[model samples]
Target: MASSLRLLLPLLLLLICSIHGGRGQPCSTSDIRVEQRTTGASVEGQPEYQVTVSNTCDCPQSKVMLLCYGLNSVTDVDPRAIKPVDAKLCAVAGGRPLSKGTPVKFKYAWKTPQDFPVVSSEIHC
Candidate 1:
């Protein structure tokens, strides 16, 4: 009985690890994709750009923060859509969980398009 139990335990542990690690593919900042394009509109003499943030992971991601140092738009954006966390980061969707297919979008006006790289997120599988 003891021998069987020992063998069973190791197999069970391995099975659990594989299940968790293999399921849904572990997500990270790389799973977040950012796309920005000119909207052909001007705000306060600055060209407007539309930004879309999407989670490519199979699972939902929450608390999605992006690098946004020195991000200032002459056009006003809703705080709930995106807000500054500090000098170097900003949170998206009010830090709510983003679904796989649904994307969060917002627009800003500037002389140049701002780049938003994913900084951190909590992946929910």
Candidate 2:
């Protein structure tokens, strides 16, 4: 019994370490790139923007989260009116994984008062 216990102890430790090791390994920020474009005009008289997230890593990226916010007329945007733009790609459960060199694209529309003019937007992954 003592001999078997000793053998199992190392195996158990190895298994635990393997399981937890991956949790510490997150995808590198440098491996991803975010690109933005204005896809024509808004269909419903709103401002529309398209964002693409590309994975430049050699490994697959899973459950990636991207947040986007839009600002209209930098100086005049109403504080109460500020809100996150639509994240079309964010609707996927557990995030949509991308293979190396692949890209994911989404669109967002900002609702602003007439003549508010969107000046800039920000995205973070």
Per-candidate TM-score against the hidden true structure: 0.79, 0.44
- Provide C-alpha RMSD values for all models, in order: 3.6, 11.2
Instruction: Say which candidate scores most in TM-score.
Output: 1
RMSD (Cα, Å) of model 1: 3.6
Consecutive 10-residue window with the lowest summed lDDT within model 1:
16-25
Candidate 1 error regions (>4 Å): 1-24
TM-score: model 2 vs. ground truth: 0.44
Name the regions of candidate 2 deviating beyond 4 angstroms. Answer: 1-27, 69-94, 111-125
lDDT of each: 0.86, 0.48
Whole-model lDDT, model 1: 0.86
Tens digit of lDDT per residue, candidate 2, span 76-105? 332221333363222212344565666665
